[model samples]
Target: MPINKQQVRTALTHVMHPEMEKDLVTLDMIEDLIVQDSFITFTIDLPEKNSQLESHLKEKCEEAIRTYVDEGAVLDVTTAVNISKFRDREDGRGEEQAFPGQGHRKKKKRQKDEGEEELLSGVKNVIAVASGKGGVGKSTVAVNLACGLARTGAKVGLLDTDIYGPSIPTMMDTHERPNITTQKKLIPLKKYGIRFLSMGLLVDPDQAMIWRGPMVTSAVKQFMEEVEWGELDYLVLDLPPGTGDIQLTLVQTVPLTGAVIVSTPQTVALDDARKGVAMFKKVNVPVLGLVENMAYFIPEDRPGKKYHIFGKHGARDLAERIGANFLGEIPLEQAVRESGDAGKPIVLEEGLESRSAQAFVELSNNVIQQLAIRNQSKDPTEKIDIKIRP
Candidate 1:
């Protein structure tokens, strides 16, 4: 059979643009799709021409096409750098250049209330991974999910915004403090191909952030505005436990794409998780879905045994009751904690057919699939919006 253009486009739609966080087809990166019999050729127009992501893109395209087409098909990939898209705006020539003469050129007036306005410089989507209370493994889910997205060729950024206890630096095994650029922007630390910034890096590890609400809010605002996160597809914010000042400030200041509530299968945690969901609803921030972390503990030796140490299906039940998408459940495992301590995410480690890692991978896939569906419209609750009164 002859190669089909629609099939090729459909396959490409599932391939996300690493930097833009959008699909290759949606970003107009995939072009000139020519398929003659078993041979396939296509051009990918990058925003800027560089070797930064050439090999990775080629490999991903080949993998995606092969899944749909014949494995023996000829794949020809070409990339063109469109520098015009990345060029700085040129000053109109023939006009008098602003000189350091008699009257100094008027300074560009900065926006009033710039301090109040929080913006993520180059992130396409800001996802707050939050929990109602602590000990729900919110940070673990955030880190692994960020890694999962990165593994799938998305340029992901993880922000450890838990001021009181910023565990991301330790969890992700990243220790370097962000460097300031000439533009006065803070450059985030990179680890496992994901960019990250954390309060742990900014302050002494032993010292606690003993600041009031206002100070914490200011620090978060600075983190959001001053960080030079260049062209990220998703910026996952690990919010501190509970619905407090920092959470409120983030919702008020940043145009968050949505939130994912992490909770355990315990009544206490579920109670708090519900509050987190209600808080987002009150603030009009969309709750993307619910993640049940530590849903059950499965013994490594006896894979058949699933001990519901916390409780069973608390988060999943809550999600269903509230009409929110139940993203997925992550089993409680020692490897997850060990990985966090070792500064490596379990998602990056070889699972050796381990169920915990498989759970994470499945969770990541579900989140991505939901995100793609959500991106198709503005309403976050378009598919599943359950009205729950606090």
Candidate 2:
């Protein structure tokens, strides 16, 4: 039988992107699809050209087509990177916000009137994992933190509010669509004992999210209020890097208990990490601490030797300078990276045996301790025992 466009699309949905962990069809990557008798062709659109991702996805798409279509079918897949549609729309005014380190100062706005904001009911504390810039392993820290907290038997919810670069779905290895409850709340996806949600799950992965300030804020507000995050002891929000619209909207919308800043042991990253702490303070959110990721590299062959790749204790000094707690430092490790890419966090995959996994556990314990000191609330440790379930 001849191949059809609908059949091709259905097949494509099973072809998960290696990095995105979402199907091409869901990412809106499949474009200009044409099918003839036992022959099919489609264009895979990308926001940027990733030769590795493109090649991997192309192979997956071809494999999927063959499985769904008749034997001896011919498939032609093309790749295109078009970001024009995703460009920021400018009004009569010039650029909306200043670039990083270029005197980006936003006037602090007062909190909204009472009753204007809705809280996620039953969530005891909300913690945000944020960085001043990207490539500092903020998402990785957020994911592992959530898993670590869950390992402590706390009911945890991971909310990926990095709308522009949502990576939680891929890191957590979940691609299931959420179902709406009878009360009209969206059910959160579960993995590694943590309930989570991300824009990657709700929208096409391949499409660039070029939403304006208002739109970005609205989506985050909805995610915070509309999702049925039931009785969470700790709700960790993986915020997008920088103090942009999403960051402002989140702090303004919800009463954040605290924020954990992630940064590398590099001057540039430390500079941005300071800005992250400042932003939270501007919004009256407590800066719980700073976590230094990729702090050092320990050679696998020589475990005793430590090399300061980015710089030694850069984040620790920054934390002290900013008057925030120095949570802990996570070393550079291949296991951590491989675990995240495989859709399972290292904290859950490695347990307490490995050094990287132990760091995450220590980080989680410190977070709980800091919150106790900050809020003087009941001891979280007393409420739940430490139980790391696979």
TM-scores for all candidates? 0.68, 0.66
State each model's CA lDDT, in order. 0.74, 0.76
Superposed on all Cα atoms, the candidates' RMSDs to the truth, in angstroms, are 16.1, 18.0
- Please give, for residues 75-106, the per-residue lDDT of candidate 2 as tens digits: 76777653422232223233332111111111
Compared with the true structure, what per-residue lDDT tens digits does model 1 show for residues 23-121?
A: 888866775466656766676766554686877787788888888766777887776553322232234332222111101111111222556432554
- Among all candidates shown, the one with the greatest TM-score: 1
Clashing pairs in 1: 173-343
Model 2: lDDT to the true structure: 0.76
User: What 10-residue stretch in candidate 1 is worst by lDDT?
Assistant: 100-109
- Candidate 2, which segments miss by more than 4 Å at Cα? 1-117, 205-208, 377-390
Least lDDT summed over 10 consecutive residues: which range in candidate 2?
Answer: 100-109
